[model samples]
Target: MKMTDPTTSAATPDEELSALVMQISSLSKLALDMTKVCIDVKDKLPHVIAAQAAKIAMAIPETGETVSTPWFEFLDAPTPEEMAARYPSTNGDGQNYHVVCAGRRPGLYADPDDATAQVTGVPNYVREKRKGRFEALRFYKAVYREGRAFTAIDVIVSDDDDE
Candidate 1:
């Protein structure tokens, strides 16, 4: 395949990096919001509300392709060739790669947006999964690139992955 122009591919790596960084940030924010909801109220947050927030909070990133859902089926979604044109693979660094996340809570529901939530053979990596409810109503991010891929750099969560 013909590689994208340098100016075009130049932003690909940065986009991937930005995606991963935002993922970590989002996970942290979700955990924080859930904890806040738990502490502020006497009861657990409603699943629908939590679910909705989760949808909004967890966003799948796009470089050229659009994320119909945040988690699962990134491949099934449509991509504008012009958007795909922006990403040219790095020699080995995976500069133009993509990202998806799925967390399995005991009450986990299949979100059209969740990638890991949909597949069984793949691990849900519940260590990082958020459990129970959100207070914030708006939990969505728009199409953009993360600072890095989820697996590319270090992520620091306050609690243990299983906690």
Candidate 2:
């Protein structure tokens, strides 16, 4: 199919925005279609093709760079489940806390401007420091690309741990 050059004049900013919205809609539909195909094929898909798809899915569109840190290196961090296993869920006073998933922000909720503050799956961290023990929130580098989609997960050491 012949692709239109995005640089071509759209006449107005509203027109450009509309075009962008349509493009996004098309992309989303294509992604859904692709997902269906992948589900149907599953194990039958070739390793190389699967690898390329993974890379594409994890890549930064502008730079074509993988958003995730190296898998082996990321695996070095302690997962959220591991952290929960090691740490006490509640204090002696009965104040409950949990390793809640978050993004860049140290809090459980994402900041309006920081998209990376949104959490997805289980988060991981290098280690919880002594200072972090006393704080209400602690942010960690996300190990997986999807986890990093917004940023890092937070270990919320507060009664508000609702994740």
Computed on alpha carbons, the lDDT of every model, listed in order, comes to 0.34, 0.40
TM-score for candidate 2: 0.21
* Candidate 2 deviant stretches above 4 angstroms: 1-10, 43-163
Q: lDDT per residue, candidate 2, 1-163, as tens digits? A: 8677888953588888999999999999999999999886774455435434544443323465543442211112244444435454344423323323333333322233332323233233212222332232334323221243122323345557756
Candidate 2: C-alpha RMSD after superposition: 20.9
Worst 10 residues of 1 by lDDT: 135-144
TM-score, prediction 1: 0.21
Residue-wise lDDT of candidate 1 within 49-136, one digit each (tens)? 5534444343434368764432431111112232234333234431211123223211122243453433333222221222222200
> How does residue 48 of candidate 1 score in lDDT?
36
Candidate 2: global Cα-lDDT?
0.40
